[model samples]
Target: MEIQYLGHSAFKIKINNTLLITDPFLSDDPDLGIKFPKIEARIVTVSHNHHDHNGVAAVSGNPFIIRTPGEYEVSGINIFGYATFHDEKEGKERGRNTIYLIEGEKMNVCHLGDLGHVLENELVEMLGEVDVLLIPVGGTYTLDAVKATEVVRQIEPKIVIPMHYFHPKFKFKLNPVENFVKEMGVGVPEKTDKLKLSKDKLPQETKLVIMEAS
Candidate 1:
């Protein structure tokens, strides 16, 4: 499968003939201008109802969108959506969000959209082992660096991709990507514009892959 970073928490994953996009924030990010290419997909998975995560209208073609929390199977992909609170204090204000686990072609991909806090034991158990983890590391709207690192430890994914941080286009007051990278002291990170991975190419140890927005 190939993964392309589309700024903020958006990611396009291509597996075989299936193209899945997560939390597509395709517009002028409020803080940053157009940082990534404006592209459409065959399927769009939204984690929550937030503006950044639910910008499905920006994408053309009117792809099949899975927004609510549930399990679904489409085009050989097994998708599991779990309901969770979007705040650290556990639903104190923001209410619930959906955490998605997509299984396809021997690979398990997890996207924690605007995940604001740590995962509970049940959630972790339900997630199982993930091959790739697309997570939010920016503080204001999601888990900060420290909390993100802890989430990684619990999930034990083979690959971790950080997102939702500050960029030149985003006009928010969130911290930069460096904050998350610096906190991952022992994580071996590779900077790239895109990434392609298969079941055989899965890393043995957890790796932090930083992709340029676009």
Candidate 2:
């Protein structure tokens, strides 16, 4: 399987013969100055209606789209979306966020889009075992560095990928990824433009792998 980060909560994933994308961010996030590549995905998912996470139009091809919590199967891949909040106020402030768990090729990849709070015991139990975790570590709109560290501990994924945090190209007010790294007591993680992972390569313990936006 191959994973590429498209900046600001967006990722393009390739598993087996299937291609999918998560949280297609708008090309022009005046703040982020992000110009995503022209992508054509067989399946697209929007974590919520937010402009930064719901750029379904940016994706080419009439892709199968998922936007709510449910069980779905498409292109030989299985997906499960769970209801989550974008703010601690329970949507009173920032509306709902959806955390997606994708299963395929003997791996489970979980993408937490703008998750605002820690998971309850039930949600944590439902997550089960995650091979790769995409989490938000930037504060303000999502979990801050400290909270994200907490979430990592709760889920205990084999590979952890931090997203939605500060980057040179990002034009938002948020804490830098370095803050999260510090909180984790791990030094700066190795940066890769893409990750080609398999069940055999999964680390025995949690590993932080940062992907440079390509």
Candidate 3:
């Protein structure tokens, strides 16, 4: 599998012969002024109704989109969407959010879209074991660094990729990636513009990878 960060919470994942994109925040991002390159995908997944996570216009005209809550299968990929709240409490303000679990290539990838706070027990149980977890660490609209770390511990994914934080172009009040990386306090985190992975080469332990937005 190969992964490319498209800025903000958007990511492109290539698993087997399929391309899966999540939370496409291209074109609409005011800070970066970055326009997304035209790309084709077999499937596109949007976690919620937020503009950052649901840039339907960024996708090619012919791609298949999964937006509602349910189980769907297409081109050998199995996707399960569970309804969850975006804010800390119930949908008092931010309204509903969907967490997606995609199964394919002998791995399960989870994208926590604009997750505002810690998850509940039942939501955690539904997620099960995540091989690759794409999470939001930007606090204003999602979990802060401290809270994100706790979520990572609960999910226990083999690979954790932080997203939704402040960038050069993102106009938000949230802290930058430094906060999260500083808290990690381990070896130097691998910083790359893109990531390539395969089911046969899955890492044994949870690894935090930081990728540059394209």
Candidate 4:
């Protein structure tokens, strides 16, 4: 399986012939001075109803869309959406959020869409095994660097990819990725364009990967 980051919280994942995209934030924003590239996917998953995280219409190919908590199978990929909150106040602050676990090619790629609070023990057990984690490290609307690092410890994924943080082009009041890197006590790794992984060759210890938006 291969994963490509598309600025902010959007990501495109390719598993064999199937294409999957999460939180398609494709609209051009003057504040950010950025535009998403044209991409097609068989499946799209939105964590919440936020405009920034739910741009399904921008994606082509008439993809199957999942936005709620449920179990679904698309193109032989098993997807489980777990109910989560967008804020620590139990949705009083932001609203409900969905954390999706995409299972394909014998690996589990978990995307925490705008997750605002840390996971409880039960929620972590529900996620089971996560090979790759796509998480939001930006503070204001989601988990900050410290909390994000805490969550990473909870999930204990082999590959950790931080997202939704501050970028010069993002124009959001959020913490920088450097904060998270610091909390993890590791020097920043060189940013890569994409991440390719196979179950057999996954790292034995947790690894932090910084990805350049494609």
Task: Report how far residue 65 has shifted in candidate 4, in Å.
Answer: 0.5
Which TM-score value belongs to model 1?
Answer: 0.94
lDDT of each: 0.85, 0.92, 0.83, 0.91
User: If the candidates were sorted by their TM-score against the true structure, best first, what order would they fall in?
Assistant: 2, 4, 1, 3
Which 10 successive residues of model 3 have the least lDDT summed?
25-34
Alpha-carbon RMSD, candidate 1: 1.6
Separately for all candidates shown, the number of backbone clashes (residues 3 or more apart, or on different chains) is 7, 1, 3, 0
What tens-digit string does per-residue lDDT give for candidate 3 at 44-154? 999888766777778885778998789999888999998877888777879888889999878898988888878888888888989999988878777889998889988
Q: What is the TM-score of each candidate against the true structure?
A: 0.94, 0.97, 0.93, 0.97
Off by over 4 Å in 3: 26-32
In candidate 3 the C-alpha lDDT for residue 119 amounts to: 82
lDDT of 3 at 42: 82
Give the per-residue lDDT digits (tens) of candidate 1, residues 125-183.
98998999998898887899999999999999999999888876566778877888889
lDDT of 3 at 62: 74
Give residue 134's lDDT in candidate 3 (0 to 100).
91
Q: How close is candidate 3 to the true structure, as a TM-score?
A: 0.93
